[model samples]
Target: METRKGLKPALVAAAVAAAFAAPVEARITKIEITSRGPAFGGVEFPGVGAYERLVGVASGEVNPASSNNSMIVDVNLAPKNARGNVEYKFDFYILKPVDLSKGNHRVMYEPPNRGGKTFGPFNRTTGGNDPSSTTNPLGQFLAPRGYTMVFSGWDKAAGTNTANFNATITLPIAKNADGTSITGPSYEYIVMGNATTTSYNLNYPAASLTDKSAAKLTRRARIDDAATVIPATGWDFVDANSIKLLPDGTTFAANDIYEFSYVAKDPTVNGLGLAAVRDWNSFLRFNVTDDSGTANPLAGDVQKIYTYVLSQPGRLLNDFRYYGFNQDESGRKVFDGMLQWIAAADGLNLNLRFSQPQRTQRNRQDQLYAEGIFPFAHQSTTDPLTGKTAGRYDKCLASNTCPLALEVYSANEYWVKAASLFHTNPAGTQDLADPPYARYYLMSSHQHGTGNGTARGSCQQLGNPLNANPTLRALFIALDQWATNGTAPPPSAIPRLADGTLAAAMPQSGMGFPNIPGVQYTGLKSTRFLLNYGPQFDSGIMTINPPATVAPFFDNPANGKIYPTFVPKTDSDGNDVAGIKVPDVMVPLATYTGWSLRAAANGGPDGCEGSGQMIPFAKTRADREAAADPRLSVAERYGTFGQYMYARGNSIVQLMNQRLLLDEDAYAEYTAGLAAVRAGSLLKDE
Candidate 1:
């Protein structure tokens, strides 16, 4: 091949001669095109119409007979002009894939025709379809550009007979002034239902009609332009027994404030089984650092700003979105107009801040806590009524109240409770312990972190098991009413407990405990200790070395208190104190509550037992077996138990606030304001 700029002109000429020397065969493969017109609703075009035309091109070249063959030829188009037969001269060429020796074979068109009757080979530079030309614009563009447009004929598959057909034309590049060839790019175009095709008879020009258009305008209007408002009217608790109240007589009402703090610790470092360190680290990075490196403002800052806005009297805090619960980074921007509307309706002032727990060194207790494993102990307090030393020594950690700093508990005890209390619940209720103003909503299929579930509903469902329910819409409606009318929304309808039980209405006179039965207690020491043991450690008992035993404890109705006694010593030489072989010291224990506990009193066949089993042991057969079977892992099973408990706790907290914290009427008014704002109608008056 003759080379110019690494390309050959002589070789091109010879190839063109060779192509014409032998009759070449080819086939039409694929085609596509577009036309200008008014946009239809769902369909591509509205009604049948055509306007001024624009530029277009058609292109395709002869395929090689074999992998190694190449050829070309001179091309000509004849037209019957007024002066008689007129001929337009053109050229053609053949191209093979770059690495033919390596068996790679493909074809491409290079620099099309230069100046026969056409100014350039491609329509782009050829000045063909000028929209401004009022008369014969389509003809001027198509004819000179050498585009053979075609219209669709009746096809059984397509009901209409007027679809457009894409066109392709193949020809060679013409020589430059120096006799060297001008290499240009290949070109292709589509003719709607108003142009000609090569297959159409020359005499029947009308039959060659293909569609073409000059210009068309398209517009998109926003349909769902709206905002989510916080409700003005406070929530009401018709069922008085549903919530608890505080001593001050203030209750949980609308617009009341609360704070929440949570720590998302890294999963235990187990040589075997799935470790949570990766996910925990990810959560920390998302919440505390800018992982995206975009330096976007932290969610905490946004929350603070929102709180500041809400603090202003009569202000609605609906413009802001919050996240970072369970250390998940998720949220959205509200419509600016919506923010203005809220401000105008309620006047604004509130403060929000992201609370991050201080990281501390992990202790042996922490390690055991992470694995959901712990030592069992029964602390007994002396009962004034019971004269005898009546106490039961048993493992009570298996109960639902056991405390463990697991992710599930972190979500429930912190995220759900805090969000419900401050963000969702109403104010002005007698209850302070467990306010009833807020409704606790749990996504049926939410994962550990927010947005780790499906993205079907709110921003919270950003991750895994997605729920396609319309519950979010309901929440919005309920929130709107609660904020405006002082009418608190009803608690979410959930599955009944195993005992087929239902909780009482809110605002009862007496203290109310969590529905977790024996789990409910006011003392922080018991709450934390019990929850850590019950859910975190005991839950993983079956996987512990030397299979553990499970025991249940119930409160003693007779004495009204729990008592404990020391375990018997087996050694013969050991001093026998209390008649039996046990020690004289008395251990504290509670009455036998219905709750059950699992313990390994003696080292079982699996490995170690009881207190020794709680140690981090990846070498044990039990640990290895549990790692291979997901059902055996504490994190895998009952992981959401803590979250549920937390939500329940939050519900109670809100109810209590409404009954005890604020003035009744003032609480009602505040709740009404919130409802109005949420309903897209903020109250103007104080």
Candidate 2:
């Protein structure tokens, strides 16, 4: 094939072309391109000229009998094709340079987070879902460097493919050996509505909507509160998939937790979603054409590949490696490196019957789902509770397919997502070391979501304004270098039990928190429980819905706490003492914290889910004395605005030396810090 117009062909194609020719197994039967056009309206991206966008559906089959797929629940029960293989189809979106030969010959696949494109974090832009335009601008960081960005549908619940809701998959429904519909207990957690709200949609269809005895509804004021059952007569199902109050004009109180348990039918071979990703990446890397002769869009254009997943999809990547999906059908590695943000140590409920991959464990919600389990670390460590000896990367490690992995968590994850388990033993007694291929970093004093520099109150206290964008941009580049070359990224920077940085959650002394006025430090954190999902849990069938769990508190002699949790000890300024101290934390304008409490109107005392706090420092020493604030005032510390900027610049230089802050991002950080200082009116002698 002749090179495309304006593409400068390179020798990298010949180097990897041999691998494409050596592929022997084929799972992707057909690829149908639905739309093809220029991306960003043919906007030139500096060194990399105009880019092209292609939207399509890729259909494939998986052999249930293969060792690579046998662990999937009900794979044998799924309807098969003529050759006895389970079939699946997923939507895909590709944005690459118009002339591939001149590009970097690398692919970056971002699995959609709830069917929504999440390239915003990496691109430093937000707003639109359509990634092919400046509406959700693809900032100069990713595309300008000549990367081919890709996205694909992996979750059926993510809904249909549209401009806003793209990247969805269709999987075959699982059935009994005799082809009967499979039924099991499914759970739906709903946050109640206000006066005008009437009903909510269920995740799955109820097998018998009218069978009141088979369905149960319960309400609780808090996650740990005892459940109060609502009589079946009190509420009725509007249909097989929605419910509402019993009497007209009746309504549920806003922010209350409601749980509905019912018999649900037709479990899709949801595990096929993993196979869909594996094979899709394999097709792009090692195949020139599909069974239908549809040419691989980037046929010889891909050499190395990486994946970036945030939040819920981040947990999916953990499950993807746990289930051994990293090894493709032809025994080839799929992703070369992966970057996960805010996932913490959580697992996805993606490989089981009636799996709800969308559900995640949080402080005040979705705590009972099977999202937090054993094997929380990448390296094998025996669980003290379950006595299981396994790791997230065991299967891939044994198969020699473990990719270089980096997990970055914000302070919010520690409070709500059980992030400490990633480094510590399951008992949280001792810190475990990461293997050579893995590194973990913490974004000090940040929340699950980024915030603009401000002290606006959202939950109870001021919202945390410590953004991780600059640091993450640096780490993303570091991760790519670690995969592309043999360059080692920065060492892992997290709080340690051995050091004083990692401390007990309770008691202000343990956390080194100052007595900031109007701020409450309850030391509230999401606790983990060893849940019993019946004997078949090891086999991927969670027979128990809302499974029974052990007591939240324990009298154990060794640890004294069940799955003990810890938070980063704060400095006198209430910023985290450990982890990568972003400019906001290193040169502080406020007391940023990982934990925030809900307002009394919402739900008192409990954590405002995945939120952090930002309490600004007093502008002068007189203000600090008047407020009785123990920490020094901003004026007392920096004296002048220029002095503050000078200190922040030094910190940035140190981070750059550690390779945690890229040179390009330093200018932006400097300007943002300067603007924030001026906004707070912390100038000298003002």
TM-score top scorer: 2
Q: Which ranges in model 1 have alpha carbons more than 4 Å from their true place?
A: 1-436, 449-464, 468-470, 492-527, 530-686
Q: Compute the lDDT of residue 143 as modeled in candidate 1.
A: 26
Local accuracy of candidate 1 as per-residue lDDT tens digits, 466-498:
111122222332333444344555443221222
TM-score of each: 0.16, 0.94
RMSD to the hidden true structure, all candidates: 36.5, 3.4
lDDT to native, each model:
0.18, 0.80
> Worst lDDT window (10 residues) for model 1?
580-589
Tens digits of lDDT, candidate 2, 111-181: 89888887675677663467776653346567887889899999988867475638899988988888888
Report the number of the highest-lDDT candidate: 2
